[model samples]
Target: MKRIALLGMPNTGKSTLFNRMTGGAARVGNWPGITVELLSGKILLGGDMVEIIDLPGIYDLHGFSDDEQVVRHFLHDNVPDLALVILNATQIERQMSLLLQLKRLNLNVVVLLNMADEAKKYGITIDSKKMAEMLDMPVFLLSGKYGAGYPEALQAVARALRYPTPGMAEQLRSQLEEDAHLESEMARVLHHAVQIPVQMPEHLSDKLDRVMLHPWAGLPLFFGIMYLLFQGIFLLGQPLQLWVGDALGWLRGAALEPAVGWLPAIVQGLLLDGLYNGVATVAAFVPLIILFFLFMAMVEDSGYLSRAAFLMDALMAKMGLDGRGFVMLLMGFGCNVPALMGTRVMRSRSLRLLTMLIIPFSLCSARLQVFVFITAALFSPVAAPLVLFSLYLSSFAAAILTALLFKGKYQNNEPFVLELPPYRFPTLRQMLLRGWQEVSHFLRRATQFIVAGVVLVWLLTNLPPAAAPGGPDTFAGMIGSLLHPLFAPVGIDEQLTIALIFGFVAKEIVIGALAVIYGQFGDALGSALAQQLDWVQAYSFMLFTLIYTPCLSAIATLRNEAKSTGFAAFVIVWSLALAWLVSFLFYQTARALGY
Candidate 1:
């Protein structure tokens, strides 16, 4: 299949356009010498199945940064049949330099002036006909978010693909000599093709950013927004979660129990109770997972999330870390594994390592599921959101403090640069596609791992023919019982201890493990916990789960990406110690307070 490369600077709606073209059918993979991922999808274009690769957003093809180098190598080594150079329409005056430099290559190229709605809103207009005449290429004015002119854009790509290109090595050499001042000169020349508004009217995004980005207000405002998000997850998501949980239970009873009964007792128990129950328990949290990702996707698409990186830069600098590190930490709230991958954007190796160390502490949605589940089951509506929000704030506090301690240990000397996109209303199609992509990704990556862990735990708790399931003589029970004295101070019982052990594989399965061990599911499982533990111990348990060792995949990521077994080992060791110490302190302090 022929290839179409989507090229643009960061936050120029490149990814948005990619999703619009391919309908969110993206595969994420890594190429040589870079840990950053590449997104590509297959789409039918003009009677041919074409591969569209969304290259990393880079300002210059010849730039030196890691992301830029990836784009540069991909372009020169694996040159695509056509390049769709996407430009932010509002910022086209300055962004045109990138398109002009690529034009120097004399390849078949098309300029996609994206974000046309926002551009028009800003009273800016682009003469695509004039631009096409000057650049000797097609230019399409459209909104990637709103799906405006997408068909025409694809038609243009088809036309661009039909053309054969000539070498421009001499043109490239001349351009390279004048590259330093190219941006200003390009802006000056584009004056004929673009018109700007004088005395620009204030934008809604600007009005909001003034408060959201204010030095005195940004952090608190961020926290307030986060509190509401958690509230939404519980308040809005609880009904959906309950519905899903009840449906799964009904399916298990109506179909799985009867279907498995034909097998031998052991097979029936393993299939029905072990794997099915475990998987179902994890699946129950899918509602909240969907809700969180939906909220995040909308926030990201609207572009206010980028301002946060700027708002927190001073705080990050205090810890000798860069704003990019904090941005990766924010990404972790969606998924820690990808957030770890995002650290590749950091130029300094020390900063990357430090950021990698902090990402696991960023309260990923998996862990948040456990927290939200606990609060929804154990606390009042008014108190549940507060507790959930506290957990989030605590996670960030711990991550930042830990980064500060390691800041001097690993010295880094790279400056921070980030693009703050103008906020706009993301289309419902874009929002739904993003949410579905995230949900599918989670299920694809996590289902097998979680089911396996659940079955393994069930087996360990049920083995040895003479012992009862999860009883003292069973493997997990024996192990947990033996460690009871050590765990007792922190109020971790055998069932909870066993659940924590299984949590090593993935945090999302921890609750399912609890349900299996106690021979319960859903609300019954939460009821069992309520009967067994008091408020202090319950809080302590949540604390430990929050700070415990990174999940198995995250640990492997640290080892592979940091390329140091010792560092990965150190992370595990320190995390375990911290989890225990913090849980112990919280439990003890609560008791002393006479709660």
Candidate 2:
């Protein structure tokens, strides 16, 4: 199929447009020369099936950042049929430089000035015809978010593809080149075709920024927002989580158990007691994960995410990171794998490595699931959110402490630059889509690990035909017993020790492993856990989970991205050591306090 590449700088609504064009059917795959995954999907335009590849958002094609190199290499290797460059209309002046770079690459180009509505609201208007004439490319105004002028832009894409730009092949045969007068050319086009008010009316975002970006108030406001975020997740998701758990319990008792009743005892144990309970336990948190992504999507699309990054940059700078690294760390709240991969955006290896080391402490959804379960089981409803929020704070504290300790070792001198986009309310569709995307990602990637980890735990606890399941005679029990002395002061029992070990594969499996270890499922598992540990111990386990090693997938990504086994090993060692020390101290102190 013919190909069209979606190219743009960050915050240009490129992703929003891609989703609208492809109807959220895109698949993520790594291109031949690209290390990171890119989203590509097929959409029919004018009776022709064409692939749309969404490239990473980059500031400059010639820039040395990893994303820039990926874009540069992609254009060199894949050579898409047409490059549909999207520019933020309000920021068109600076964004047009990327369009100029693509032109130098001799690719057929069509430009869409996205967020036209927002631009117009700022008293900025562009004459598309004149701009098209000056730039020698088809230029159109579009609101990728609101669907304005999208039809015309689609038709323009179809026309550009139907009739390949003349002399393009001849230009492709020539060496890739650069133009020095990009700024002049862009200025000339803007002078003839765009109009901006001398004193533009102030925007609502500007007024909000006065408060949101204020140095004194911003940090507290950000903390408040995050506090509310956790509370909201617990309040909204608690019922749904309970309902999912109850449903799974009903499934096991009413359907799965009876259907497998005729099977052999080992088979039954493996199927029901191992696989079913393990996977089901992790699956119960899907609702909470969805709610989390939904809230994050709102914060992201509303443009407060960048504001938060800006708010944290000063402190981050002291830690040898910048605003962008903080953004990646926040992304870790969703999943550490992608956040680690996101470190590629930084050109500085030390900075990326530091960010990767810290990201694992960001309280990802997998750990969130475990924390949610523990907090709900151990604390009163009024205190549950507080406990969960405290875990989040501890995660950040751990990350901050890691940064402070390692800042001098992994030095980053790169200056921080970030663009704060205007705050826009995300549509309900966008919110729901983000939630679904995260939920789908979790199911596809984490579920297998959870199921496998739980099954492995079950076998370790049940194997050797003569040994009682999860008893001291079983392999897991023996191993946990061996390590119990090390963990005993921290209030982690032998059974919990095995769960922590399996948790290295994926934290979501912690709950599942607990179920298998206790020979319980769903609510029974929670009751069993409550009986096994007091509030202080439960909180200590959470702190350990919060600060311990990243999952296997995150570790692999860290190794691959850092391209250093030694660095990855260091991350593992430090995270584990810190986790143990923190948990041990907390458990010891809390016990001394007689809580």
Q: Which candidate is the best by lDDT?
A: 2
Off by over 4 Å in 2: 164-180
TM-score of each: 0.94, 0.96
Would you list the C-alpha lDDT of every candidate in the order shown?
A: 0.82, 0.87
lDDT of 1 by residue, 194-252 (tens): 88988677988788888888889898988788777777778888888888989998998
lDDT per residue as tens, model 2, 1-595:
8999999998899888888888877788888867778888898888989999998899977778998888877887788889999999998778877787677666788999999999999899899999999888899999888788999999999989987643334333223353557677878888999998888899999999999999899999999999999999999999999999999999888999999999999999999889898888888898999999999989888999899899999999999989887888889999998898888878888899889889999999999999999888888999999999888888889989999999999998877878889999998878876677778878887767877888898899997879988889999978988999999989888988898998898888899899888888778888888988999899988898889888898999899899999999999999999999999999999989998
Cα deviation in Å at residue 156, candidate 2? Answer: 2.2
Clashing pairs in 2: none
